[model samples]
Target chain A: MNKLMVYMFKNFIRMLLLLLFVSITAFILVSLSPIDPLQANISQTALGSLSQEQIDKLEMYWGVNEAPIERYLAWVRAFLHGDMGTSLLYRQSVASVIMQKLSNSLMLMVFAWIISGGIGFFLGILSGMNRGKIIDKLIKGYALLTASAPTFWLALLFLLVFSVWLGLFPIGLSVPIGMDAASVSLSDRLQHAILPAVTLSITGISNIVLHTREKMIDVLESEYVLFAVARGEKRWEIFRHHGLRNILLPAITLQFASISEIFGGSILVEQVFSYPGLGQAVVTAGLGGDIPLLLGITVISAAIVFAGNFIADILYGIVDPRIRKGARS
Target chain B: MDRIPILDIQNLSVSFSQYVDMFRKNDLQVIKDLNLKLFEGEVVAVVGASGSGKSLLAHAILGILPYNASFSGRMSYCGEPLTQMRIEQLRGKEIVLVPQSVSYLDPLMKVGFQIRKSVNDKRSKEKMLQTLNRYGLGEEVEKLYPFELSGGMARRVLISTAVMDSPRLVIADEPTPGIHIDAAKQVLGHFRKIADDGAAVLIITHDLELAIEAADRVVVFYAGMTLEEAQASDFSDESKLSHPYTRALWRAMPQNGFRAIESIKEADL
Candidate 1:
């Protein structure tokens, strides 16, 4: 128990450091960007109509006139006290905006994660067990092609085929544009999410498929597997007993580690789909120079990715007793 | 004492087809005309140098040769011809293998579950516990994974896994490697005990001293061929050995002055 506590404490420290690094990096890059917040958000006509004194007041209010260091310190101070400031673009609290956007993105990303893992694991097992066969070759070819293809390109292709050509699904957005929030059903949201979710899942699936296939091949060829066969175990019986558990750990590790990729890909996927998710919000904040919103998203996304890896570490112990014993020691 | 042998193998030859060029393939013979008989209540040791194709014999009996390997042989179990289908049926139930490395045990699985295999009946569970107890292993050892075991304990666990089904024939492939002398002796003794209980035991190894100590008969393999097969007692006198290579091996024993003729290759002798 004491060891577990220490391990958790260490992880907590590492998470804090990662959040700090990500926030600082995002802040620096945003600061260096040539896009001026005032110029990007306010029209030229509005700037021309304002008097010099009024423009000074507006600049002060926006914290544009403040030094970069003082601005960063103030933002950090406010953040420590649960004040994520307000979004320059949305005129709302950064936290609430993120919360709303995150819920939508979470639904989309979770669906993609689950679907990719399930399909990838199944395909990997098939390819690995029947290596050099026609099915293996086809799966390998598909995985390779999909892994190298760009996420935005795939999203456009899905949108064109499913929405434009076939007229089967919506072209874009989380829901129908004029639909009332109260009137929308689960089916409506799912119908809208299916395209983007599938597009995002396509890229995620290839990596898992390739990694898991390699791991499955290795497990099948291990000495223990040979012994299992020598023990009179049938092919499927050996797979059930010796192959599954050994391969499961590596698959899980790859699954969780791919969260960063999933998150990264959603940025492009959300843009192509025009979905009102955190990924789309990130682009909005980045373009409009909403530092508070961007920094908040940065920290949260880092935490989420780190949390995924942490869960994988914990699961390693549960899935394999050897790792658990090693941790105890 | 003229009863039919429990396991009979004759004129067994194994070869592998290897690609020397893109189109040309060569057949590399690994085992040639290897013949042996193992009766119930006796242990036969196929003694040879390490990597001398002794393991191929065990693999041959289990019907697990690789894809490119081919064999021509007659193998019978209990007076019946052992075909591929027959070996498949008998393996893990009537016949079992105690493999060479500790790695042969699945690292993720508990020892008890591995021993019991697919049988989950209360009677099989009792039998598993009895087998472990017979090997002087505590019940707690069953819950431990293979990595948690000491060398000797793991060796005993491997033996227990093989004998749990009360198999008619047990083939142990180089079971004593990487273990201390005393532990090695203990493992050999376990095989001897298994044979004494009316199962035929085939132990493939390179340790002539250990073989002569534990086996009823010893077969010497040189260049993948059976050069000599003699009673264990015949090793006591060099003149009693039929083959010149067998006499060279007897003289090479440490107790026999560790002598070797220049004509015999160091690897083979």
Candidate 2:
């Protein structure tokens, strides 16, 4: 337990460093975008309410007149206290906006990951079991084609075929707002999620399939596997006992990388379908130069990547007894 | 003596498929009409040059031979035909193999984990620890990784792990292939113990001296064919045997007693 704690502590430090590096980089990049929020807001005259005095007060209230560093400090202070800044477009707290969108993206991410990992891993195992069989060849060919097919393009194609052509879904939108989160059924969200999930999952799943197949093939030929066979241990025993345990290391590393892939899914598929998630929020923020909103999304995305990698590190210590011992020592 | 041999192989011919081309591919006959066996309480030493299908014969009996390899003959465990049995049915329950190189063990895992893997019962830990101590390794060996040990240590660990469950037959391929001269005796002693435990042990090596010292019987292979089979004491005197290959091999050992086998090449071997 002490060793595990040490391992966890080291991992925590690593995550913090990664988080800081990402947040700083994201803050700089968001600040670099040329659009000014106040400048974008004057044109909201189409809503036809505010006078010049009212606009000036609004600018001062949000610290638009303050120096860049002071404005950054002010936002950063509130941000540390859970204030993500107010969303100008949504006319709501930035935290509230993200919370609403985050769940949708998370649901899509979870479903897409399950689909990609499940299908990819199964095909990979089959391909591995038959190194040069026709199925292996066909899967490889298909994976190659899918890898080259971009996510946004795939989303558009799904939108055309599934939504537009067949009218299978609600034309790529989230669950209608103001509905009770509890009464809003799981299957209903899943129904809205199919095209976006597929748009994201197919390529990732194919990549994992290729990787897992190669890893399984390599592990199958090891001396322990032969030893296991000679010991009269069943084929499945060798696979699960020796093979799966050994293969898990690389599989998990790929899983860590897939977290980023999941985020990438949201950007393209979510934007294409206007699912009102982080991707859509990012677009709105970028268009209106909402630096605080963009910065918030950027840091959260970085945190997710850092957390994914941290989980991988913790798993490494568990799976590899050597590392676990080292931590103990 | 037992009425049925622990294992019996009769006129076994194993062939492997070679995907030479699109149209005219041919099968490579890896082993041909080979016959060998291990009897009750016997230590049988198979001596051969590499690629002579000695290992292929081992694979054939183990039922882990590649899918392309096709074999025809009688191979059985205590009267049951191994030729058609599943790998799980034939191996470990009746026959267990300790591979030549000890490198395949997960470098990260300790000695205890590798041993306990084959013997799946939870209480096997105590038995494994006892076996490790019996092999003259301290309890520290159980805690150390493969890399932390010497070549001799790794070989012993491999042998100890193999015989943990005391299975009926243990097949050792080139058991002393990469072991130090000091470690070869220790490794061979392991097989001798297995055979003494009333389990048939098959030792595969090119070193006739080691075989003569360790085995009750010796089977010689030349170019994937068994050329001669002789009792261990008979080969102790080199002049008694007359197969040209085994004779020349017996002559080639510079120091008649315990000649070091640096390599197993056939020509320059």
Candidate 3:
């Protein structure tokens, strides 16, 4: 118990440091870019009659007159206090804009993640157990095709088939544009999400299936598993007790490591389907030079990545006694 | 007095089907024309050099051979024909194996949990603890993982796991390599004790000296065939050993002047 506490504490500290480093890097990169948020907004919004005093006032209001490092420190301080600053693009608090879109993306990701993980894990075990058989070969081919296919193209194909031709699912968005999301039924939300969620999950499922299949094959061939069989352990008992536990740790680590790529793919899928998710929000923020909004999104994404790896580490300590012993020592 | 053998294997042959080309296939025979029997209250050490099919013989009896390997043999356990289903039923209770590699221990499991396996009853737990104690392992060692154990400790744990159930037949495959000499003898001594308690123990090893010291009878194997089966006392003199290969092996022992013999081809043997 003491060792577990210490392990969690250490992981927490590492996550905090990683977030700090990522925030600093994101802030510095955005600050050094050619685009200036205040100037960009002013030139786009103002007519030719704008005065120099007005320009200076806008710069002062946005804290652009301060040094870059000072501005970053101020942003960090506000972020630590749960204030993500104001967005020049949306004319609202960055937190509010992000919070509004975060739910949509979270819904899509939750569906895709659960569906892909379940299908991938089940098929991986089947293919691994019956390696070189017909089912294994079929899954391998499917994995190859899906892993290489472009996400946007797949989304367009789904939209063409399911929305335009069959009319089975809505083409885009988490909820209908004019309807209040709170009043929407759960089934309606699901109907709208099916096309985009399936598109986003195809690649994730293929990648996980391939990774898990390979790992399970290695685990099955391990000497201990063979010994378990020789000890008269039932086939299911060996898989349940020995095989699955060994396979799950690496599979989870791979899942967490692929989060960024999954997020990147989600953006392309969202844009193709016109989904009202954080992916679309990030696209608009980038094109509009919404620095505060962009930085806020980057920080949240970094936090998710850090949390994923942190969870994997804790789970490693829990599932594998060798690691737990090492941590305790 | 004719005592009933606990395990009997007759005319055992093992071969694997390998694809030689895109279309052609060949059968590679690994073990052929093998026969052996083990009676209760005796330790039979099968001694051979590496690649002599000793371990395969052990795997064959345990019914854990690789998928491609095909076996044609007659085997019986206590006068009943031993089928695959019967072996599964008897394994780990009536019969058990001490595998060759210490890697056989699961890295994810604690030593105690692995030895107890599926049985969590009070009697099984007490028996496990007693077995571990007999092997000189402390209580704390039960909580340690396989990687945490020293080579000797892992060997002892493997022995404890095999012998805990008081099996009728025990097949140990090269269980003493990579441990201290004294520790090796101690492990063999434990197997001897098990045999003395009436279980038929088969210890497969390449160490002729150790076999001669611990076994009541020694079976010498060459090129997947048994060359000679003799009392361990016969190994005291090279002339008393029957086969030429067995005599060569005795000469090759360090205590026997380590004489180098010309390579004998399988066809000649």
Candidate 4:
């Protein structure tokens, strides 16, 4: 128990450092970008109509008049006190906007994650067990092709085929247009999420499949597996007794690590589908130069990705005693 | 000695199909005309240099040879033809292999559960404990994983796993490499005990001296063929050994002046 606490505490320190680095980089990059918030947020006509006094007030309010380091420090001070500030474009608290959008993104991401992991794990084991056969070739070819394919492009293709061509699903968005948020049914939300989730899952599936397949092939070729085979263990028995536990640890690690990929892919997927999730909000906040909103999303996403990796680390100790012993020592 | 040997291999040959060129393939024979018999209550060691098809012979008997390899031989287990299907049925139970190293034990599995395989009944657990105890391994060792075991403990665990089913034929392939001399002898001593308890033990190793010490009979192999078959007592004197290669091996022993033969080929011998 003491060892576990130490391990977790170390990981917590590492996560804090990573998050700090990510936030600083995001802040610097956003500050240096060419997008002028005054122009990007307001039209030329609206800017021209404003008097010098009104323009000065707007610039001061947006902290455009402040030095980059001063503005960053001020934002950090506010952030530490649970004050994420307001989204200039949304005219709402950045924290509330994030909370609203994050729920939807989590639903989409979790759905895709489970689907991709389930199908990919099964296919990986299948292809690895039947290596060099036609099924293996087919799965390998699919993984190769999909791994190189871009998420936005796949999302567009799904939108075209499943929405425009077949008319089987919505073209975009988390809820039906013109429907009240309180009135929307679970089935309706599920229907709207299907295409986006499917697109994200398809792109995510390739990595997990390839990694798991390689691990499976490695396990099958190991000396212990050969010993199991020589001991009169049949195919199913070998997989159940020897193969599964060996492959499962790596599979779980890959599955959790892929969370970052899934989140990144969700951004492009959300754009193509115009889904009103955290991914779409990131795009909106970035374009509108809503620094507070952008930074909040950045910190949260980084935390999530780090958490995914941390979970994988903990699970390694649980699944394999060898690693557990190493960690304890 | 039993009238029918536990395992008999006659005129055995093994070859693998390999692609020599882009479009051409050929069969490369690795073992030829190898013959040996392992009777009940005896330990027979097949001693040879590495890659002399000693391990291949073990794989052959267990029907675990590589897919591309082909063999022509007549192998019988207790007077019955040991066909592929028959070996498969008897594998892990009536017949078992004590693999070369602890690496042959599943790294992810507990030592006790691994030996029992899927038999989780209370009685099977008791038997597994008994088997471990027989190998001087305590019940506490059962809960440990393979990596947690020391070199000697790992070796004992392998031996325990093999004898858990009370197999009639036990084939050990290079069971004591990279271990201390004392520990190796202790491991070999376990095999001697297994044989004394009425199981036929076939040990494949490169250490001729160790083989002679533990085995009742030793078969000398050279370039995939059995060069000589002699009683372990015969190694005490060069004259008692028939083949020149076998006699050269005797002279090469450290106890006997450690004579260095310039070459091991038949002509040189």
Candidate 5:
């Protein structure tokens, strides 16, 4: 237990250092870009008659007039004190704006994760158990097809079929335009979430299914599995007792490693569906040169990636006893 | 000596279908015309070099051969035909196998739970602990995983797992390799005790000395065929061995001066 605590502490330190590095890099890159946030903000408004004095005041207020390093250090200081600065694009606190969008993205991610993980695991076991059979072949075909198709195109295709033609789901937005979100029914939220969630899930499912199938096949052929069979353990019993944990350990590592890809893929899907999620938020922030909002989103996203890996490492220690021993000694 | 044999295998042959190309297929005959038997209260050791189909014989009896391997054989256990279904039913209860690979233990499982085969009852748990104790393993060892064990401990755990139910028949495939000499002797001694308790033990090994020391009978295999079957005392002198290969193996023993013979390849056999 002390060893596990030390392991977690070390990983926490590493995650903090990585987040710092990401923040610095994001700040520097945004500073080096040609687009000036004040100019972008000014151009976005209908203020052709505004005086130069108003522009100067706006620049001072936003700290754009300060040296890039000075501004970054000030931002970091405030961030450490729980202030993520005000967004130039939305004219709201970056934290408040991101919190609203973060929840929406998390909801989409949770639904996609559960759907993809459950289906992928089940299909993978079936395909692996019946290798070279028709079910295996069909799953392989689906994997190949989804792997080749782009996420945005798939999302659009879903939208066209389910929304435009069939009218099964809403075309865009996470909620009805006129309906108050707080007053909306649970079924209304689910109906609005289905298209974007499914679009995000399909790609993840394909990747996970292929990975799980490969790992399951390898585990099924291992000496221990064969030994279990020789002991006359029933097929399901062998799978449950021996096969599932072994296969899932590596599969989970792969899943967590692919989290960045999933995050990136969700951006395109979110755009296609106009879902008010972090992915869509990041895209809008980037285009509008909202550096503060972009920096906030980037740091949070990197933190999410690091957290995923950290969770995977902890799970590794739990699942494989060798890892726990290694952590101790 | 008229007791019905616990296991009787006659004219057992195993051949595997192999794909030579996309078009051509061939049958690779691995074992042919092998015959062996084990009566109650006896330990029989099948001794041969690697690739001599010794392991395949054990797998065949256990009905765990690969999907493509086809075999023609008559195998009986306790005076009844040992069909696949019957073997499946009897396995882990009436018959058990101690596999050769240390990798055969599940890496994720606790030693005690695995030995009990996940039977959650208090009786089985106590029995599992007793089996581990008989193998000279401490109670704490039950909580350790396969990776935590030394080679000898792992071998003992495998033995403990097989004998937990006091199986009627036990087949151990190369159960002593890589273990210390004393540990090997201890394992073989345990097999002797199992036999004395009325279970038939078949040990497959390449160590002729161990076989001669531990087993009541020795069956020699050469190039996937049974070369000779003899009383273990027959191995005391090279001249008492009936087959040239058996005599060659005896002479090749370290105690017998490690005599060298002309290389006889599989093609020559």
Candidate 6:
């Protein structure tokens, strides 16, 4: 229990550090970028032809005149209390906008991760067990191809193949055949999300397959397997028990990072398919220079990434003794 | 006694080959017709210069030989064909190896974990500690890693792991090398108790005096073949030896208890 307490305290410190690093870096980076947030906003709004006085008033109103540190601190302070201010273009509270689209992104990402992780784990185990066999060769070839291919390009190509050429599904929208959002079934929602999810899953599956395979190879060569085999343990039991436990540890940790990526990285798929998601909100806000919304999404994305990695470390500590020993909370 | 040895070998040849050319491979023959045997419950020691296949015979019997080594002819364990048995099954539960150095174990594993690993039961943790205590290794040795253990303690722990599983045959390779004689004797004494428990122990070493004092029977090896086989009592009467190599090795041990021989001398003795 004392050890658990120490671990928790250390984890809290790490969480704070991750938040600090992400927010500060994001703040500094956006502040330094050449794009004029005011101009970027004016061009997209009725305020484009306004006087310099109105622009000054707008800058003062938005607290853009404040120091970057002060602005960042104020933003963080507001975010902690669930107040992310309002977008200049959309004129909606950042939180409300995020909540509106969070579900779509979640639906796409969760299913993507499940599909990728499940398939990757099975294929990895298969390949590792049959190292030089035909299945191993096929898995290796597939993993290599998917990992090297750009995800955004894959999303575009998939849109062409599945939505355009086949006419099997709608191309750029989450609804089927102009159906009202209020009447859409859960099955329809999942069907609409499938292409995007597949788009998101390709590289993720590749990463998991590659990592699990490498770890399995290492585990299979370990002395414990030899010892286990000496005990009359069947070959499949070695794969299922000792081999799986050791290799899955690293894969489990990777699972969290993949989760964060799916959530934060579904932007292109959402855009190409016109799926209303937090990713779409962020992309629109970023390009249109909606300061509050962009800053809010950036901060949230960073937080989610930080949270995913933190959870991974803790979960990994539980699974792997090597980590559990040295990796304190 | 039955005429058939507990472990018998006839023309047991082994080799390793590597691809040296596009259409050809080079073969390295490590052991040639290495005929030898050990009896049940006997503490038999094999001693020679390094690379004389003292370790290879143990590997061949246990079927833990490197992938390259192609072995031929019969090598049996209690009249059972060794080559045919699953290599992994023969280890720990059947034939355990007390390796030359204790560092051979996975360094990441705890001493107790390695001990438990040999027995294949997670409850082997508590059981191993109790078994270690029976062999005179106390409780503190359990939590420590292999690096933290004293040379003597490490050796004893290796033996503790070996016998924890109660194997029928324990092939120990130089169980007491590079340690002081006092520690060596202490370890050898432990080996004797293990042999007394009705297990066949094949010890490979060059320490003639240690072998004479500890082993019930000694099989001497030179250049990958058995040179001589004799009972421990037969050593008192030196004329009973058959092989020139065995006679030379026996003559090489210094008469003084602690003092080792200065050098081995012979013009083909």
CA lDDT of each prediction against the hidden true structure: 0.90, 0.78, 0.85, 0.90, 0.88, 0.75
**Candidate number achieving the greatest TM-score relative to the actual structure:** 4
Query: CA shift at B42, candidate 2, in angstroms?
Result: 3.4
- In model 1, the Cα lDDT at residue A265 comes to 92
- Expressed as tens digits, the lDDT of each residue in B43-74 for candidate 3 is 99999889877888988898988888889989
Q: Model 4, which residues run further than 4 Å from truth?
A: A326-329, B18-27, B180-182
Candidate 5 TM-score, true structure as reference: 0.89
Model 5 spans > 4 angstroms off: A24-82, A179-187, A251-259, A325-329, B1-3, B265-268
* Candidate 2, position A20, lDDT: 62
* Residue-level error in angstroms, candidate 2, position A308: 0.9
Which pairs of residues clash in candidate 4, taking residues 3 or more apart in a chain or in different chains? none
Across residues A246-326, which tens digit of lDDT does each residue of candidate 1 receive? 898888889999999999999999999999999999999999888899999999999999999999998887778987887
Worst 10 residues of 2 chain B by lDDT: B260-269
Over the stretch A1-329, how does candidate 5's per-residue lDDT look in tens digits? 87777878999899899999999998888888777666666665645666788877877866677898888888899999989988878899999999999998888888888788878888888888788999999998898899899999999999999999999999998888899768988788788899899998899888888988998899888999888887889989988898887887887787777677778888999999999999999988887778789999999999999998888888887777788776677
Positional deviation of residue B48's Cα in model 6 after best superposition, in angstroms: 5.8
lDDT of 4 at B226: 85
Q: Which ten residues in a row have the lowest lDDT in candidate 5 chain A?
A: A40-49
DockQ of 5: 0.66
Q: After TM-score superposition, what is the CA distance of residue B181 in candidate 6 from its true location, in Å?
A: 5.6
For model 3, name the residue pairs that clash: none
Worst 10 residues of 5 chain B by lDDT: B260-269
Per-residue CA lDDT of model 2 for B1-269, tens digit only, reads 55788888899898988878887769888677778878878899989877778888778878778877888888778777765554456466556788777665765456677777745575787888788888888888877876677777778787776776768878888889866676788789878888888899998887777888899999888777777889988876777786766766776676664344445456531
Off-target runs (Cα >4 Å) in candidate 1 are A42-66, B1-3, B18-26, B242-245, B260-269
lDDT of candidate 3 over A255-284, digit per residue (tens): 776676678878998898899888998887
Model 4 per-residue lDDT tens digits across residues B1-269: 54998999999999989999999889988889999999999999999999888899989999999889999989999999999999999999989999988888889888888888867999889999898888888899989988899888988888888888888999999999889989999999999888888899999999999999999999999888888999998888888988888887888889998999557566743
- Over the stretch A1-329, how does candidate 6's per-residue lDDT look in tens digits? 68868877997788777767776776787777666666666665667678889889988865567887787788788877878888877788878887777877888888888999999888888888888789999999999998898777888899899989997776866667778879999888778888888888886788888888888888777655654454445678777656776677678788888877677558877887888888898888767656678877777777777777878877876766555654443
**Best of the candidates, DockQ:** 4
